[model samples]
Target: MHAIVLVGGKATRLWPRTRWQPKALVKIGHYSILEIIIRRLRDCGFDRITLCIAHLGDMIKDEFGDGRHLGVAVDYCAEERPLGTAAPLHLVPDWTSPAVVMNGDILTTIDFADLHRQHTTSGNLLTVAFHKSLLHAGVGVLRVRDGRVQQIWEKPNVEWNINAGIYVADPRVRDHIPRSDAADMPGLINALLADGQQVTGYGFSGQWYDIGTPFRYQKAMKEFLTHPDRYLRPDAPSNGNGRRNEVALEPDGDRLSVADLSPWS
Candidate 1:
């Protein structure tokens, strides 16, 4: 199956590090986040991949030229201006078949083949990957009736199924996205739902991380170091070494500073 990876965001939240480069080039161990994502897609038998790039797109083009090294055919759709998440789908070339669309910064072990199969057979225009996330209240909560407290639950946990930034979209869904202006995925989904089009959510129970911020990046690094086998390819030499690979960071007294490690190292 074909796939479209969105790597266009400025990623301002990951400032300083992202100030100079796109988040797609952010390193996790010896591989950049984009490399890991491409490798994952290749492993799942996706032969055709297209990257929708805007910010610092030239760097990405220079890094993964033609995708030949990764054993997949790679193409690029360079947006002249920033197009939000789902709008870039309209830029994909010959995107007549059902395809996988996802964020470039996400690190997950989700099975893409299964998602493709489910979407194809279910007759839905769109199938979104979802994960259950817990929302914890910071302060105490109380149930009051007639100005009298009947029950009190402190720091309650609310379980919510959130969008996992991955989607299987039918070719027809592209019609919903405007040709001009920016559009996000949530807006697309809501439009589909409002029109009574079939939109399904596929829940996955696996390791998933959206490395959009420094905290999340560090957390993903730690998890990947702790359990490399779960995230790395079976043949990856670092999978079973049980060793912590050094990332591109060094101690700056009490703080940490970015180091100049080769992204492909």
Candidate 2:
């Protein structure tokens, strides 16, 4: 199966660290986030991969050069400008088989092969990977009717199924994306849903991290440092001392205020 990995975000939330480098090049452990994603895709039996790149794209091209070292045939789809998320699908070559599309900065142990199997057999136009997330209100809340307080709920937790930045789509799914404008994944999914197309969400529970912000980057670094084995492949080669050397976390800089520029919801 072909995997279209989107590695072309400005990553404004990561600030000065990503000011000169692409988010894909950010190091989590010993390997860059892009390398880890490629290795995982290869392990999942995806032999052909396409990287949609922009924002210091040359560095990413220089680093992964043909993907020979990673045991996969690598190809690239360069974006002249920021094309949201789903718009890039229109830039990539058409596919006859189901293709997996995901953000390149995600750190997860998701089983792509299983995802593909489910997507293909279900006969859905699109299958999105979803993870359960909880949002907690930081302060107490009150409900009032007219001049009287009806009820109050303090610090309630809201549960939601979040899009995990991964998707398996049929070839026809591309028809919904606009050819000359910015269109996001949420918009595309909504279009499909409004047209009565079959769209389903596959739920997963495991180690998943979206390394887009400083908080998430630091969290992923700490998780990999503490539980290196969970992030590393079992077949990965070990040092002569029979242990894998963990990569040091990069130093944190002053936090920068980032606008909500996420293309995906």
Error of 2 at 159 (Å): 3.0
Which stretches of candidate 2 lie above 4 Å from their native place? Answer: 134-158, 234-265
Predicted structure with the largest TM-score when compared to the true one: 1
Error of 1 at 31 (Å): 0.4
Give me the candidate number with maximum lDDT: 1
C-alpha lDDT of all candidate models, in order = 0.80, 0.77
Clashing pairs in 2: none
For model 1, the stretches where C-alpha displacement exceeds 4 angstroms are 135-157, 234-265
State residue 139's C-alpha deviation in candidate 1, in Å. 7.1
Per-residue lDDT of model 1, residues 1-265, tens digit only:
8999999999999999998899999999988999989988888789999999999999999999999999999999988988899888888888888999999999877777778888887788998887644556566555565676664545555445557899999888878888878999999999898888868777665678999888999999887787766665633342122111123334232222212111222
After superposing all C-alphas onto the true structure, candidate 2 shows an RMSD in angstroms of 10.3
Residues 12-53, model 2: lDDT tens digits: 999899999999999987989988888888887899888999
Q: Could you estimate the TM-score for every candidate?
A: 0.81, 0.80
